[model samples]
Target: MRVAFALSLLAALLSGCASHSNPSPDGAWINQTAIDAAAEGGNLRQALLAHGPNLEWNIDTKGGKAIASNGFELSEGKIVSAADGKLRIDFYGNSFEDLTLKGDALVQTATDSGPEQRFKAPKEAAPAGAQPGTSFERGLYSAYLGGKWSIVQGEGQGGVVEFQPDGSVSGLPGNDRYALCLAGDCAAMSGEYDSMWLEKNEQGNPWIFVRSGNQLEIFQAVNNAKADEMPDLRPGASQWVLQKN
Candidate 1:
């Protein structure tokens, strides 16, 4: 039974990692808002490792009515079930409670008193480093941090951040601010800090992310993680992940 349980969990975690019916962009809730938020802390691996599936959508729907259309917006006391899995989460106004905790999906429904949400045991869970200092695994995860990133969020004239393997990150979409880094450590980064990542929901994709702080933002996150996507930027600007080299 113990072995069976472990197998079940593994299956659950790998659910959508492989080939599967992908979620449409419009249908995905972990869109721009999430990416922007995560960028503030800007630790995709750690952020995801500390995952609870933060979502973005309007609830009151009053001024922004579709009124409860997405049924995503919630008041301080509201609870919600996840569309991604079987987990129930309680809200505390600012953020969801019971986050990152191992569990099942939460169910949300209207009741006489108010809406109620419940969490089901999670199927399979995301894998994690057994210890805090697993150099090999951590290095593998951070490899993508190497490269230049443009701000793809702000509509009019947003900002962009470039993460270089040389231990630096920078860009100027519309600001005079700048930063230099030698590692993924957020605390050590120079300049004003504000950025995050938006995980990919579809298959065969690396992930979509953005960095937003103050008045800067990126809309859709994309990449050229594959070799076929790399190429020189200028005569020698270096290849990118998505665009064919």
Candidate 2:
């Protein structure tokens, strides 16, 4: 179930909007034209939705921003406009695209008379592991590490810990009392000992650990391209990962 949840989350992040906007990006939107162009009519909408080209628009009082992720290319930019109800966004300050709001979605067009492209909204959330009162099954397991937006399988033992339904864990390093918190996509297990939680590394991917029996895997939940760039740690050096019987 946990694995399925993680996969689903990844799917949503990759193919769909699965967004969280203070203003809700007016719900997720997708530029199907761009998606189709990138896929070259290979019936890859579903795959593209999970591993294709897409963008996210987050607008609020602070400012309007856009995020575009397709394959290994990630573009982030501010939404600029001089006319009412119009948006022009420049990604990485290299190129600019225009968008107009229609009803509840953002519509993109190459020219004033061009066909329209659309972006749709998806789900929202916080990190799974650190959510307060959250629980994992009690058992023994191995561990993995997250990098480049994907989980690195068989990295090592994250911990041989037992998750109790009452919101506590045992057998973690130091045998310390730990509590679960759901702040970002990763949860923080705070207590007597150090906690291993998922957060964005040098790259903007959420790296975290998940347990499944004897396999506690660490993964980069968002971007998996540059995962190999993360530094390696020798066993027993970091309490974040541990072994169990």
Q: What C-alpha lDDT, on a 0 to 100 scale, does residue 36 get in candidate 2?
A: 35
Please give, for residues 176-198, the per-residue lDDT of candidate 2 as tens digits. Answer: 33232222222222111112332
- The segments of candidate 2 whose C-alpha lies over 4 angstroms from its true place after superposition are 1-52, 111-116, 123-245
TM-score of each: 0.19, 0.32
Question: lDDT per residue, candidate 1, 140-201, as tens digits?
Answer: 22343434444433322233455432223345333322222112333122112222322222
- Scored by lDDT, the top model is 2
Error of 1 at 223 (Å): 30
Worst 10 residues of 2 by lDDT: 134-143
Task: Give the residue spans of candidate 1 off by over 4 A.
Answer: 1-142, 153-161, 173-245
Weakest 10 consecutive residues of candidate 1 by summed lDDT = 63-72
Q: Tell me how far candidate 2 lies from the true structure as C-alpha RMSD in angstroms.
A: 17.0
